[model samples]
Target: MEKESGSMKSSSQTRTEGSKEFEFTARDFERVRALIYKKAGIALAESKQEMVYSRLARRLRATGISSFVTYLDRLEQGSGETEEWEAFTNALTTNLTSFFRESHHFPILAEHLKKVKEPIEIWCSAASTGEEPYSIAMTACEAFNTLTPPVRIIATDIDTNVLNTGANGVYSIDRLDKMSPERARRFFLRGKGAREGQVRVRPELRQMISFKQVNLLADNWGVSGPFDVIFCRNVMIYFDKPTQGKILDRFAPLMKPDGLLFAGHSENFLYVCDEFKLRGKTVYELDPDRKTSSAKLRRA
Candidate 1:
């Protein structure tokens, strides 16, 4: 009992040194920012310290660690380090998304499909929770007016938890609030009995997508592509310019020369990447001239 009491006191001292509520310091915040940038290419801002503390504080408590520093140390040099890193990466990833987000893009996608005579391949590089990829499937169906459209979509993200959610293809009924009633009736089935207040994507739509956990910053994506279109939306805001440039460089090799790239409303890639030219609202087309220039530069 005496030894247990001493151990309890030591734990209390450790917590007091880096108290749960207010002990996250500037240095600690910088360390976290650096680590996340290195691991995931997410360039967190100084303003995000509170968010980091709130998100990671739960981790420290779950691990029974007293302070952020100690938790970080354990993360850096510990058994099960891979799992811990996955947890850390998952904790920091922001996965805010909704069905048919940026509705204008769908019409453009439909038109683009009309011009293609062959099978089309697409990549949704930041398909959070499955909404965007499923939306792509829906648009393809609408464009082709068929149950089994010839569109192949690869939807990927770094969060395994969300990938599972996306793969399951089930969502709360409230998720359909923003979607049109016709679309809701067409693409999703209302759950019944024990599954009330939920909906599942119809098998037709689910089969159109292949969901996987992919970290965009990783060395190899393992995805063979000459994709006709790539949807990488609302993700560049979290990365620095150099990281964004590197991603674009990698994307150039995976896309066909005439392929389209759709971006989020707030992301403007005009200055970040020269290989894609702004074609329309938040839409980019591969720049033939820049492609030639890149080839020349590589040879030189």
Candidate 2:
């Protein structure tokens, strides 16, 4: 009776595991977690197993690979950079952004822009689909009361796919529903005829930003700074505390003494790095006591 019961339990477990098109064992999930962490500094939680499977399953089908093992092996064994690797990273990347996301930050940013007399340099560290950077540009324009603000924004992301979308500067008109109609009309050109239901950002806003592919985990971010503002919102939550500290340390040298760092609503930089102090809400400024000469010199 005991042996029969054990066999039935094993059979039930097998049926459960077999429900999906792909065989995803716990070990496969661990491998994915480790690889993504190494590649992108993203610390995937255990709860993400199903999400990973769902996303990668499409990659597996697209590549005509029969199993996760084979698909992962191809990625692991590949030399240097490959299209598949890019696809893999892009697939796993979660891009949830909208025009003027974290709306409160924009008002603070506008206030800061007004205080600075010099031409401004801003870095939108995760420019996903271009909305954030364009919003920044729009804010700058409004602060200065002109279509052309003396601001240059470097918008970058690790996912080249999204970088391409950002550079295109086109989106469905509905994406603008939250903005005041005047703001929307001022910033976007409505599509007509064949392109109905879409809107393109004004050329001035698009021109203010330069899009690039940047991996925060990389030794070199491929962009220089002395930036007045760095918008690193929502991107750090994916990284472990140590990775977040290292990135914050790197950010310190690249910013002016009075420069501001904008973090996500839930992110608190106070515990992560000592270089910055809370300025307001999620905004951070260089710690007065820890100000470095490089930062001061950068401003001069």
Winning model by TM-score: 2
The global Cα lDDT (0 to 1) of model 1 is 0.87
Off by over 4 Å in 1: 1-22, 291-300
Every model: Cα RMSD to truth: 7.2, 2.4
* Collision count of model 1: 0
- lDDT against true structure, model 2: 0.91
Error of 2 at 87 (Å): 1.0
Decoy 1 TM-score against native: 0.89
List pairs with backbone clashes in candidate 1. none
lDDT of 2 by residue, 125-187 (tens): 988888999999999999999999999999999999899999999899999989999999999
lDDT of each candidate versus the true structure: 0.87, 0.91
Q: What is the TM-score of each candidate against the true structure?
A: 0.89, 0.94
Query: What's the lDDT for residue 119 in model 1?
Result: 88
